[model samples]
Target: MFIKSFRPFAQSLRAPAAIILVATLAGCSTFSGFFGGSAKKPQPAELQPVVALVPARQVWSARIGEVTFPLQGNISGETLVVASNDGTVAALDTRTGRDRWRTSIGAPIAAGVGSDGKVAAVVTRANEVVALDNGREIWRQKLAAQAFTSPFVAGGRVFVLAADRSVNAFDGQTGKKLWAQQRPSEPLVLRQGGVMLAVGDTLVVGLAGRLTGLNPLNGSIRWEAPIASPRGVNDVERLVDLVGHVGRNGNTVCARAFQANIGCVDAQRGALLWTKPANAAQGVDSDERYVFGAEADGRVLALRRADGEPVWSTDLLRYRSLTSPLVVGRSIAIGDSAGLIHLLSREDGSPLNRLTTDGTSIAASPLLAGSTLIAVTRAGGVYGFAPE
Candidate 1:
């Protein structure tokens, strides 16, 4: 009776093995790419909410330097060094617009790179890198050709490059020659890493959209890796400012780039482990865990120290070439081009507090000094903003 009435059902499960096998197959249904079409409905895109900018605060205003070619802000010594296409380098007080000293670089200045440690480089149209001390000429070396890159000082070594493809390393204080080398001409023009970085025993050069490692001792090529920097842009001739000692890890030496890029290279081998484009690029300031690149597009990008990855980004362009972004007391504090100061969240781009500079364009980057926001403007303005 059971076999006749439930004949079909009994046959379907002829064996306990077959019953379990069918059940297993049913349980293996996939959510996508076959078995089952999809699970939940697709999520709809959401529009960003309109954000209201907090009011800007004003501090002080003064005309410190004149806008010569847009990207040339080569100020040095207590006097601000302002260069014009007219072959003049003006020295103004760092605090006041008052003139301190001025000299003719002998030719139309192509690059306005200088140092504050009691020296300034005066370049002629012919590519002469001269060492000047306290407004006086110390030593001048006629280069093989003209140079567009700035000078770098580190490990008691001051380095300058000539358009002729020569690299010269000299003693920072005495203006004596340490070593020199020539780079082979490549199809794509090569460039040095940045003027801002002066590490212990290494001098980094950015070339052919790559970072070249050089032994400061012998000026020899130590290693090479591709690190693309902004080549040519109106008002922005360069986008690489080779920043500081990227907390070294093992054989890898980490450093920040002016544009939204950073990398950790084998200090000895010069191999690239990882690279990520930062959302913003301007002046990068950082701590142990992150490196910050300031962007003209009005955003602050934070990258991880281990790998060049974006952790967070904050937009502050509305205020002006906002102050240099700083990592302080768990917050990123910066001043803006409009003379407004701000305290932003370090974890994510969020508004924290505010500071004001009555000055204008504080156009330069902020001095992220140990919880202090110091900035200057072309009008010879200075400010000291701190936490209460």
Candidate 2:
């Protein structure tokens, strides 16, 4: 049944024709088998029983709505702000699992729940950027194109990275359009979230395969650094959009170019430190010493922070759909399609412990707030785990 449905897609890729826009593509996972050079879906490896090496327990759990979109949870101090595809947005206390506030945008959200504690922002499917102050609708502004990446709310402004390869900034309090910057559109873009964040006074964004640093006050290009370049025969093969949830330590920011390479940049200097080939769809996490990410084939890997050199690799979760990893103190916490969160030693990719949530795929990358590790599932179940 799967093969029959994908036959036309495979045939289309072989033909020398213009491919459909990225919005037409199902998702990052939809390109998995085809882009991984396999038409057959590989069976996930059976899990072996794990003896808990690190003590942890589920502290609490909550639900919003089934998260069907590319959702990224925003952590501000002790509050974890999240959104559902149905437009429900809420900020939950990480320590107590209590709602600080919850509200709906009255339209399905394409991406969002970016918050800076005071103001929360989300983009609706109708191409509108909505801002909420303490769960009350403040203002909304229309966008020129669809946005899959969450609106970055920081430094008293909301920034949106639209799929059309344009970046816009708005006044957080008034919704007034401040500035707009556009880049040449690419033939294809990932349906998933793209990178956009603040480093000091600079707004760093992923414009196609390049990490561009822009001045927030006025949308001027401060510097640009390429993590990957287009190099394949077709648009599908050449897609190199940068995924979100990058690793940042002080002035250095590391990110993964969709199925292309993983590299770090000196955001302060707007210089590319190094890039190494990495066929991963998700983003990466880092601590002081290592950068961690999972490949599409479900291999978890660690690379040195200074240089993109492989430190260790583990295939224990091979073929299982895995979310981007989160670095806890001594362990790396990552979730899989089966709703199981695996904690591995940061020193080596050895299993430290395993945790479980509602039996559904993890919707977003695992997040850490204070000492609590939060995992949101596709079923909209938000589970919080803490060291016991």
Candidate 3:
């Protein structure tokens, strides 16, 4: 049930029946596809040889657990914490891929492994927020709705977005209820990943294509910025949930609206800085100078962070289902459906190196740990690589 999708608007418009079928199936399985059940699986793109400008090789890999859906793994200090659908949560050494500790809470996990070194939080399929510390259960709190996004931990508080579109905060130490913010829920939303960004003292969440900044202490609205405006006659055409990860550095926070655009805003004031038309399903990643993203057509692009101006774009992996790009050292890394990690030049988007994972589709962004880049696959294989 791992969902990684980038359906075009044109294709969706021609298949209203498909949309209906997906909507019907969404309630039953908690995951849905706009192309319906009859849709064919896309074949992985064949990899052609590219000149390896920089030497890179796999450092270590391990089968951690099963990821039944597109999930997020958090790195706290040197420990990488990950969760599986079957309620398994494990803390692994980021450098050696060795297990630190593992535990199974005995319920289907719905989201998260958000940690702030001391505490780890995750949602259960039974609609509960479970908090753990040092591989032991600390506390659990029931939620009114299921969560589709990872719980975010910051400033001794745990924040999560419920499926009903409410933002709930809990004490990072005791799982005590803090404050909750509610928003109008969209009729149809992506059942997989959603955006939650912590900037300074504000908790920024993407709700129905709008970015709302909240005072994490009291759950009050600091400001609201619209990332995308809904359009067209049907709800299908107006589906613009902010998908995947949100990028933040200093006061600049950027996010991508599914099938729409990528935009940045001032985290301090919630003012729109700049935006560009981006037909991207995933979100963007940023370094000091550039914001990187992948388009639905499998094009990887880099834009200047200051003005949202396009710097470079490469269609070399077109139709390959590229993951969100992760900026590593001198190269940018992006995973594909074929389990290959393509490292491209950050200067020009040229292919630099290629590495393979466990032959399962990579649904999460590659994470940088010291000099090692860690990529997780759909079947829950963790692979670490470093430039040789």
RMSD (CA, Å), each prediction: 23.3, 9.4, 7.2
For model 2, residues 269-354, the per-residue Cα lDDT tens digits are 99999999998788888888899999878999999999989999999999888888888889998888898999999999999899
What's the residue-level lDDT of 135 in candidate 3? 84
Question: Per-residue CA lDDT of candidate 3, range 268-313, in tens?
Answer: 7999988888986776777778888888778889999899999999
TM-score of each: 0.60, 0.91, 0.89
Off by over 4 Å in 1: 1-63, 69-109, 122-126, 155-157, 162-166, 171-178, 184-196, 228-261, 266-271, 278-283, 316-329, 333-342, 353-363, 368-372, 378-388
| Segments in model 2 whose C-alpha atoms lie over 4 Å from true places | 1-38
List of clashing residue pairs for candidate 2: none
lDDT per residue for candidate 1 within 1-388, as digits (tens), equals 2112111100000000000000112223212111145677433222133232333233223333332222223433334454455565555554444556766655565444455445666455566776666567777766665555556544445577654446787766677877878765322121221222333345556543356777667878877776555566521333333432133434455544544456666655678867665432333455667766555446666777667778887544442444345555676656554555456666776776666555455444444333334555444344545444
Could you say which candidate leads in lDDT?
Answer: 2
Task: Please list the C-alpha lDDT of all candidates, in the order they appear.
Answer: 0.49, 0.83, 0.76
Q: Rank order by lDDT, top first?
A: 2, 3, 1
Residue 315 displacement (Å), model 3 = 1.4
